[model samples]
Every structure is written in C-alpha cells, then in structure tokens.
Target: MKWKTASTLALLSAVSLIGSACSGGSGSGSGDSEEVKDASAKESKDPVELVFYSMSRDSEASFNERYGDAIRKKFPNYTIKYIQRAQGSDLPDLINAGTRIDIHWDSIGSFPSSNMVYELSYDMSDLIKKHKVDLSRFEPSLIDAMKQLGNGAIYGLPVYNERMALFYNKDLFDKLNVPYPQDGMTWTELDELAKKLNVEKDGVLYTGFSPSVNHLFLTNQYSLPLLDKSAMRPTITNEKWKQVLELQLLQPTQNPVYQKAMQANKGKILDLNQFAKDQSLAMFISSPLMPLVMKEELSKFNWDLVSEPTMPDAPGVGPQSYPGYFAITKMAKDKDAAMEVIKYLTSDEYQMECAKKGIMTSLKSEEIQKALGQESAFKGKNFGAFFYNKFPAIADKTVEESQVPILATYTKNLNKLSAGEMDINTMMRTADEEASKLLDGLKKK
Candidate 1:
C-alpha cells in the first residue's frame, strides 16, 4: 500500500480492527467503461495530453490492463503518458523536465516534510465541486481522513484506502496442529497457538506471529498519541504506549516468518511472506494485500486469512491507512478535465470494475459491495478471522508531516527486540526516550 496502501501492511494483519471496514455485497458495476462524456468532450478539435506518474507498484500491470487503454478509449482527446517511478526522485526530476506533469501521485503524508511539493500541488476543493462530483458517494469516514494530511488539503486522493486483517496460512495451521480462530480470538489464544507452532531449529526459530508495527496504529491501539498535542513530543513512556509495547513483547519466542530457522542462523528480515512462502513460518499478521504476495510466491501451498485478535476478546479499533479518494490536482492545466478523470475513477462504475481485479474497492456504491461480498476467496472464513476488512484505521498525518522519521527510528529498535537482541522493556524505554528527543528536534526546526 503506498502511503494509503502503505499502512494496511502495518496494523490490520498484526492487530485486530485497525482500519475502516467496508461492507460489500449488493450493487451494480459497469462491465464496459465506454465514456459517457459530453458530446463536447468527444468532438474536441485539438488533442491534449496528460503526463502522469505512478508509483507503479507490483499491482500496476493489472490496473493498467483494465484501466489504462479503456480510459484512453473513453477520453480520446487527451493523450496520457504514464511515467512509472520505479526508483528514487523521478518526480522532481520529471517536473523539472517541464513534462507538463499534469497529474502525479502524492502520498499526502509524504508531501509536507518533502518541501519540494507544497508549491506544486493544486487545491482541489473547487475542482471537486465544479465537476459536480459526488463526494458523498464515498465512505463518510474519509472526510476527516483528508484533514490529517498535508495542511489538511485534499492534495491527492486514493482510489480506495487500505485496511489490514490478519493473514494466516491454513496449511501452516494444519501442519502445526493448531486450529483456525474466529474474529474475536483473544491474544492469549493466538499466543498459545504461536507457542505450539513455533519450533527452534538449527540456530533459528520461526513461528506464526509478528507485528508489522508502526507508532500511529500500534501505539494508538493502547490509546497513545504519536505526540501529545499539548506537549508536542514523543510520549511513548505513558500508560497507553507501554501497553502497546507490552502486546508485542507478549510473544517473546515468535517471529513473523521463518518458523523452521533460528536466530543462530541469523535471519535478519522476518517478513510476512515467511509464513506464506518459507513454510518455516506458519502464520503472517498483515494486511489484505498479503494475498497478492502470497498468490505470487506460494502458489502450491493452500492458504487462508484471519483477522487480528481483539484485545481481551473485544474488537479493537485500529488498522491504519484506509485508502482515500482521487482528487484533481491544483496544478492541473485543465481542472475540468482532471476532475472528470477523478469523477470517473471514483464513480460507482469504475470502482466496481476495479473490484473484479482482486483489489478491494472503497466505493460505498452498491456495485462495490456486491463485488466484494461475492469474492468468496477474499472474504470471511469458517473459524478464521475475516480476511478482507474495513475498520477505522489511523491515517498517517505524522508521516505526512515528515514526522515519520521519528517513528521509523522507534520501529527499527522494536524489530531488533523481536529478533531477541534486547528485552521488550529495554526496547520500549529506549524508543520512548529517543522518539521524544526527535519530536523535540522537529519542533525546534
């Protein structure tokens, strides 16, 4: 999940209910996206081109195959060039090239701290209204979600926000002799299963658990704020923060992946796929997108998804990074044209179309629900947590403001602790202290 797609990996898979939950099942989706644009749009005399940039993440090909050529077919007046940013700094370089870079991807969270972007992005409220776009068609929770981003402007919007749910390998569950759990499984139960499944082998140990933890969601699970609004500094030493760290510490012996390998073998990177691919690991706590990774890597192994265990057998409000909307760029030379693109993309027709691609659609329209509800493989399971979920997730306002470096440093140490280099208490204290210092530094700057 880029910034929006980004956090689904962090909170949902690892914890119970950290993102917005969208319920889907009944709706109409347009099978064909033939442009229903005005005759004026079709009869335009001159050809206009829109140069756009995409993060071009792994899922791009599927999106392009469905969305790209069809969009061109619908809007023939505009020639669209997509620059895939496969590596670093292509955005600024491209903008410098005067490519008319009309549309670009901006993770609002990354925009503020970068300084290079504020001057470039367009304010889209007017464009949104002028196009008679139906902002109400989206999930209502997202309105405030935008407020948490760069200066509270709708600089960029996501087609759909991402929410995470736990993804467990059913084959691993069978191998470990553990049973799948229901949505409200207690942490104690999850840990008990982890204890049984985790095996220590030649210098390494791998098991069914790990937190793709980040401060915004993980810390917040215990009700900790990234910074105290009044104090404006890292306040992880508080009760909420303590609880957050304690949850991760509870499973001292488990690693997210590599159940068959041990620390003596020195596996530094214990990722979600370990359980999915390595088979050494039995379960992965991650976002819905984990399936995409699993589908590609562990084709032979049968797998399933489960939701994160709720705290004390109660549903927890979490999972960060719900996908957002697609807004018109202020820098857009043709605001009307850009809004049309966004309108169409966010419309019921387009979103429902996107649903068939295995990527969940955030549209509140009937079509989106029907598509998702019908996706049996991606939906809930018997005795397993709901695989694809929508929950109230924390948006990364901190990261968007360049405060992510603060959390990044903290998470790195947290990972180290999971690897058994340090005790949880020591890691927590150290991270809390250092994060506070970083926050202070940011304020001074």
Candidate 2:
C-alpha cells in the first residue's frame, strides 16, 4: 500500500512529544507463526498464559483489549494476564518466585535493565533473524537507546509511542477574536499568542498560556539529562539550564484564569482542571491523551492541537519520544510464544488498531498514523497537530539513567525559583551543588 510521507512524519513528531521515545535516527504476522513453530515447539503448546507487567491500569487494559485479545484470537493456545504495580516497587520477588511472565510490557523508563529484566539478543536473536523482523523499521536512535540498556543487546520493542503538543480552546480564541496558534511556532511566538489570549469575559478569566516550565524545560521538550554520568556529577549549572529556567521565569505564572480558579478553590492546584474542565485555560502543553483525560467534557468546547513550541536554537526538534516497550524474558516457559506475541504487538494491523483508539504506535509507518484516532471520540480533531514538531534524539546511556535524579533535584529548586525564594542564578547554583552532592553520594554507595 502506498503510504503518504506527510502522515509518517506527523506521527513521528507527535510521538516524540507524547513521551514516546525517539531520537533523530533514522512489522507483520500470519503464516510467519510456522517459522517460529518449527524453530521451537514449546511455545506452540496449548494452555500457555502470558503476564503483562505495567504500572498503569489503563495501559494494561488497553494492551489486553488491543494486543492480547488479538493475540489470543490469532493463537488460541495463549491466555494473557496483567501484573500491575508502581514502577519503583520491587518486582524481583515475583519474577524469582517462578512467576510465568512471558512478556515485560511497560512505559519507557518504567522498567530499567537490572537483575530482574532479561537480556534479549541471546534468546530472541535467532527468532528475530529467522523471521526477518526488520529492526531497521525503527529509528536508529531508538534501537541504540534500547541496546544501550543491555550492553548493545535488544531487551525490548516499543509497542506505542507518544509526544507533547500545544492544545488550545477554539472557543476561547474566537471569544477573544485572537488568531489561533499555528504550526512551526517558536516559544517566543507562543508567548506572544498567549499574551493576546490572556483576558476576561463575563467575569470568567481566560488564561493565555500556562505551559509548565518544569515540563517544557526540565522534563519533556527541550530538556537534556542534567547529570554527567561519566563524572558522576550534576550539570545543573550549565548556561543552557539557566536559559531554560529564565525562559519560564520571564512568563506569567498565574494567568487571570488560573488565579481565578485558585481563588475560587482556595489553595489548590487548579491549573490542569482549569485547562481540561473549567475551559478557562486557553492553551496547555500536554500529550495527545489530553482528549482521553477530558472525555467527559468533549463537547463543552471546541479544541485543537498544534506542535509544541520549539527552542530558537533547536529549531524543528520538539522533545524525546517516550513510549511503552515490550520485551520477552529469557525465563519464559515458551520463549518462542513470547517472541510471537512481541511480533504481533508491533505488527501493522495491530498497531493500526491502536491508532484508531487514539493510542500512538511506534511503528514508523504513515499508514499507521493515517489510521490513528480515526475511531476515537476525538475523531475529526487536529490529530495531525501531534506531528507538527520534529523529535529530538535521546542522549547517551549515562545521561539517560541520571535524568530522574537530576530532574528530581532541579524540580525542588525550580519550586523555590518560582516561589521567589531563590533567584535564577541562586536556583541553578543550588541545584548544581545539591545534585552533585547527591549523585556523588550515590556513586560512593
């Protein structure tokens, strides 16, 4: 089938901002089962049950409905179950206790390679090569990142991908007679657009803009890992860090809309509520899942999305893509069956179904993106907006591992900076000193 290049690029861009992992780097099923069946008969036997491990109930349910059901229907011998928990919680106990976990599926960064997670190249390599499952279909950066997790071994395959974008209220834009946000807009442009939308009507305040600084600078888009992994120290004091901090600091924190909501609620964080429910927020930066979060209020106001604003220096690059990955374990009773399941999950038919449900697929196919959100209640909305920006490449392994710790420390200091307790310079310096000390201690231990 001839797929449009435009659609593929759009999905790639959207996936980047939606937390689907991607970097500036560069699927199938059926009679294929025979190849694997011949290679290994253990997985072909009946009464096989597969465990889907994850931290989100929604992801678990989605996987069951979209992937698991399809897998069962395709291979009647298998049963799929879920094991959900907090990502931080210890799971070695369950795995070591002889629990039959064939597939380890969870969001990006949720499952780090450790004693519990199995390395895939040795066990699944033969299957991958035999099936001719094209790993090149994925971007080089993504494969590189996954391989880095296990010393250049394949540990998992991405099931779905996501990225962030600017979602806006069309009603608010019309109500204020301001032009809506456009694609390819820079942060400076967005700030100006937000300024125009910041106003009041009928005593209800409308916030022009309220993108979280932590999200834009410290977490998602335009964020780099703040630790120097080789040196075991924080790079929080870098000028780029200061630039990010200053960019947000220069903006208005509480637009009239947010302030009004806060006053009405009294000491509560109503920013998200304002954006999603109250319809007071003009624009917010978030994932395409925003539609799902605001399903109850679907028709309350007309909304649309645009690519997240980009940094001037980093034109076109939005954020790193973060998505859930599915890996087969070496300890599975039916390694062949697990490989088959992985193949099915990343297949075009299955991934297209995912797109129809408003979920993002990591498969780099325009046909998949064209099918995305087609059957969703959000159908006819600006799904293309999700793909407006380019995805940034994930950094090296050391930086990737230290992201959480560095972000954690910077988050605290960011709070102080926002609250006026510390100046930008002071905040950056303090975050650097404290994070360096913290990482140094961790390295020693």
Candidate 3:
C-alpha cells in the first residue's frame, strides 16, 4: 500500500476521479480468505481459490477473464476471485481476521499506509535474486526512488505508474490551422499555440489548456527545479509557485486555451468527463486513461496525448509519477499465498494486456509497443517519454504530505467562494489559515 493517504478510501476515489486523467497507480486485487488450505493441495487438487483485493472493478474483471481463461483452463488448478470497492473502504478489520487476502493493489505514495500497510511485507532483494528478474527492465529513476523509500531495499512492485501529458483534440487543431505541440514547448510556446487556436466566435470556444496555470500537475512539473522541497523552503513567496497560481487566472488575450471551471474548490458537480462532454473546451491535461473517460464524452473529436513541457533546467528524467502499489499485511494468515497474488498481478504479462487497452500501468509493461505501433493522434510522437523514471522520490513536507485530506473538501469549497459568492483574496487567506491550523493539529497528534 502507499505511504501517503488522506483516507483509506481516497486512493479508491482518486482512481475513478482521475481514472481518465491519471494513469493507474494502484495495484490490482481481490479478497480476504482463510489462509489454510487442504494439506495435499499440490496433487490432483481442486482449483485454488485465490482471493484478491482492488479498487478497479473494470480492469480487474477484464484481467481475470482474459488471464484466467488462458491459465485456468490449461492448468485447471487455479481460480481467482475479486473484491472491489470505491475509494475509502475500511479494509483493516477484514484483514485482521484469519482470511488469506491473497493480495491488494493500491497507490504507492498516495494510498494510506499507516494502519493498512507498510514497506515491510515484500522482500524484493530476495525475490529478484532468486527469480533472476532483470532490474534493467525498469528505468534507473524508478529503481532509485524505491531504494530511497526502503532504506535501499526494493519494497514493492508498481502496477499503475503514470504522469501527466497534454491531450488535445485534433478536430479543433485542423479547423484552426494550428500545429500540434512538439516536444519541450516552454510556457511561452504554449501561449502562442493557444493564441493561434483560440477560435471563439459564435459562442463556440476553441483554446488550449496545454500549459494552463490552473493545472497543478503542469505547474508542479514546471516548477520542480525550484520547488524540490528537498533543498527549498516551503515559502509561498517563491516566484515559481506564484506562476503556478497565475496559471489558474487565464488571460485569454495572451494564452488561447479554453478555461472551464470544473471547480475543485466549490465541490462543483461537473466532472472532467462532463466538461469534455460540453465541448466548449479544447485541450485538457490528463492521464493515459483518457480513452476510458472518452468512451462516454468523446465524439467526432479526435484526440491524442503529448509529453508535458518539462522544466527548462530541471533534472527529472520524464513522466512524473502519480503514486500507487500493493502489499500484504504482516497480520495475514496466508502471507505466502497473498504475496503470490501480488506477484501475479504485477507480472509483466498481465501489465502488457492492460497497456494495450490503454489502461495505464505502473510496471514497465511490454504492451506499450502495441500502443506505439499504430499511427496515433500524436503522429509518431514518443508518448512513452512522458513516463520516463524519476531522479528521486518527492520530498514535499507540506500539510498535504502529512495527510491526504479530501482534495474537494478544501479545493471545492473555495471555488464557490471565488464565483463572486465570496472574495478570492479572502478565500485564499482562509484556506492558508485553516490549512495551517490543520497541519499544526496533526503535528501535535
């Protein structure tokens, strides 16, 4: 399970919320069962009922159907069962029982890890050494991040590794006679592109959210060099952070990207998918799961994802991590079997299938070639560049770091206040003030 969590359920809820915007970071899973099995299990035995736990119902169901058909029919000795939930389900009580709970998939740095899980369940060094698994298969940064977290030990396997990219609709691009984004566009370049595409004449708006200041992911990446949290102080006065805030206040005359207020502060009802459905906006910064989200909202609009603009002088490799992984509890009865389940889900073969379906995976899935094989909305661009491994784990020690509070509780409520129902300066001040108090309270505890 991930070490950071606002709630046990936040990770689950995040999956659906960003299901289209963030790549899958949580590991896949099914249930809690009795660890004990019949002693003579190896011989002419009944299929092993493997219980799994997970938050993704659709992806897990698909994996079980495809993988189970191939393996189970051939071996006829394994059966898989899954237990799915929305984010925030309290699962410790179930695991505290003697139930096997074969495996659980969750976000790495985002899911709650305190009471539910930790870094100790996995013995990665042994498994890699014994299995002869090639660490070379993964990029160096990912391996380095793991080592940093586990005191230089491989703690767990990643299932849904992800980062943000600019996904723009091609229909609008053609209509506006604008060029698509190339690699390494600076904030200035993004502004020009948006200006070229801003085609709002008869109430129809065509603009770029490409480098929108309001987007936290884009702003964060742009400021990574100055805001490493490792060496820098958490000062709001930092110019880079102020630029992030400026992104939210779109100056249409300068940048042409359409601005849709899918209020994170007001607890606004419109989801990302809903905003796309309205078709008033053009580009959106989202995850690989964009296709899944588009299944409902996209129509007549051809869209593709591009690597997010990197910091001018920052050293991150590429593709920012969104944080998710799975683990077994020290309290489990069938710890061995539970661990086996984790191994299977994180296996490259399973991850490959997920990537082909455009389901974002954390493991370095081979299926990515399948996505890259065809002509795309990106026109032979290296989409994989957005996912390059990291240089170091994020070291933010802010209030959001201590606890993964409900993003909407604070962000949403503030949006309502900004719509002239309240005041912007007052709203921001209140948030900083309230958030500070909350952080101090958590520290005391």
lDDT of 3 by residue, 93-194 (tens): 454444455555555444334323332255457644433345665544456555555556665556555556666677677777778876566544566676
By summed lDDT, the worst window of 10 consecutive residues in model 3 runs over 30-39
| Candidate 2 root-mean-square deviation in Å | 7.3
Prediction-by-prediction clash tally: 42, 16, 41
What is the per-residue lDDT of model 1 for residues 165-262, given as tens digits with 9 covering 90 to 100?
55666776785577875565656677777777676556445475655565234424333445565556666566655555556443634444432343
RMSD of each: 6.3, 7.3, 7.9
Shift of residue 162 alpha carbon in model 1, Å: 1.6
Give one digit per residue, the lDDT tens place, for model 2 in 187-264: 788887887876767887777776554464433455465566467567777777666655544454435554554456
Scored by lDDT, model 2 comes in at 0.61
Highest TM-score against the true fold, candidate: 2
Kindly provide the TM-score of model 1 when superposed on the true structure, using C-alpha atoms: 0.76
